[model samples]
Target: MSTVLIVAEHLNGRLNAATARCVSAAAALSPAAIDIVVLAADAATIAAQAAQIAGVRKVLAVANPANAHAIAQVQAPQVAALAGGYSHVFGPSTTFGKDLMPAVAALLGVDQVSDLMAVEGSHSFKRPIYAGNAIITVEMPAGSQVVATVRTASWPEAAAGGSATVEAASVDATLPSHTRFIGLASASSDRPDLQSARRVVSGGRGVGSEDNFKIIYHLADRLGAAVGASRAAVDAGYVPSDLQVGQTGKIIAPELYIAVGISGAIQHLTGIKDAGTIVAINKDGDAPIFEIADIGLVGDLFQVLPELEQALG
Candidate 1:
């Protein structure tokens, strides 16, 4: 049996939900021994946490102060080298993961599978192409290990079990640098992270203004949902770019997704196509959002949102 190396992602000491999702994807590829590699400024703490993830056979820790922050240059080679012994390497399709995996693949002298949706077999994989309008099946070439970044919504998160053993590994601190962090300008919010949330509430041009976005926020709060936006809404300055969900933005697969006042475009739907239950609310009954929506509401969003919030509350 071959081993699969999963790179654990973290911020501060908390494990990113994507890491658990990766483990779930790894399980689908093979039930073979799954090992999690943690690169942290403090290895002991991260290792302790990683050991609890279900299905993890071993936790490998590499503590280098330079690795405390998630930078591609800091972790790429370390992950590449650590992944050397495994038959496959898997990570999340996050910006950090996408940046780091290419370097790791380069070090392994193989092109990565990149954003795989399904693993058909040990060597064959399926992925989206042309902005998710088509699916492409690929077979890994000879002499190269399987490398892929799983889309977050494509897999369910595994539960964390009791403790497991951790081992220490040495990594070279010196690697190539492309970009340096200045400061993080994260949006201030209590909402869930869009890509990983179980429920999502999205707004669009019909939202009218930045001020009216509060209605969507209230609805999201009542439903315990992460907030998302259409590209037009983000471009119109009603929301941040990060909140945009589409082929060009973040892809999400929530259990429930509500699109408010959004006239869904093909690009926007691509990011949310995997959502389990889709609800669309738009005054224009013919809006494309209704085409994919499980439930469609034709009404003014201003009136509908307050009523929905009241009912939920």
Candidate 2:
């Protein structure tokens, strides 16, 4: 029977929902055991939270001061050290996992399978290519350890209720000195995080300018949703790159995704392909965004937004 180990992703002592989604992907393998390893300066809280994820058999807490920051180079060696006895190692295909999994694969001397969307067998999987326009099956050599990043957007978060045990783990890998946690500079926002939000409202270049983006934000706030932007909006300097959602930016699977003034480029559609309900609002009646949108409105956003906000009230 196969056994899987997942690297836990957490911040501020809280477990990331992506970790639970990884658990969902691992569950599809029907492995003998699914364990999570939490590497942190203090892993107790995170480990305890991970232990509650359904299908998890155990949580390994690796407490080390060097793990205070999520520097890929620093954590990859430790994860590689703990890979023994496991048939597969999984991580989420988020920015953190994208940065760390390749290094883990290098340390293990194996090719990393990325953005795994489906499990065909223990060693066979399916993933997207050509900006999610196509999916191809990949088979890992039998009997070889599999290191992969799970496509978080493709799997639902595993429910909590498990009473798995948490254990303290220690890895003796030689830590690299060349890389150190310098500092992190990120925008602070009261709004929900775009990647994990249940609902999102995104603006595009047609929103006019940065100042006009307030309409998008106001609508999003009224809906209690996160704010996102099309790559065109970011490129036009109407929003920051961090808020961009497309093939080149963040891939999200919100329950509700609203695209305002977006032309629905294939690249943008690729990111929201897994969204539950897509609503498009644009003046152009025949915009490509309407091709896949569940609901579309053909009107000027500047005039429609205030009325929509009032209707909500």
Among these predictions, the greatest TM-score belongs to 2
lDDT of 2 by residue, 1-313 (tens): 8999999999888899999999999999999999999999999999999999999999999999999999999999999999988999999999999999999999999999999999999999999999999999999999999999999999999999999999999999999999998889999898998999999999998999999999999999999999999999999999989999989999999999999999999999999999999999999999999999999999999999899999998
Best-performing candidate as measured by lDDT: 2
TM-scores for every candidate against the unseen true structure: 0.95, 0.99
Query: Tens digits of per-residue lDDT for model 1 on 1-313?
Result: 5579999888768778898889888888665799999998898887888889888888999988778788887688789777768989998998778888888888888878888888787878888988888899989975468878888777888888846679998965356666655577677777788878999999999999999999999888888999999999999999989999999889999999999989999999999999999999999999898999999999999898888878875
TM-score of 2: 0.99
Q: Tell me, what's the RMSD of every candidate?
A: 1.7, 0.6
The true-versus-predicted C-alpha distance at residue 207 of model 1, in Å, is 0.4
Q: Relative to the true structure, how large is the alpha-carbon lDDT of every model?
A: 0.86, 0.96
Report the alpha-carbon TM-score of model 1 versus the true structure. 0.95
Off by over 4 Å in 1: 177-180
Cα RMSD, model 1: 1.7
The residue ranges of model 2 lying beyond 4 angstroms of the native Cα positions read: none
Clashing pairs in 1: none
True-vs-predicted CA distance for residue 240, candidate 1, Å: 1.0
Q: What's the CA error at residue 19 for candidate 2, in Å?
A: 0.3
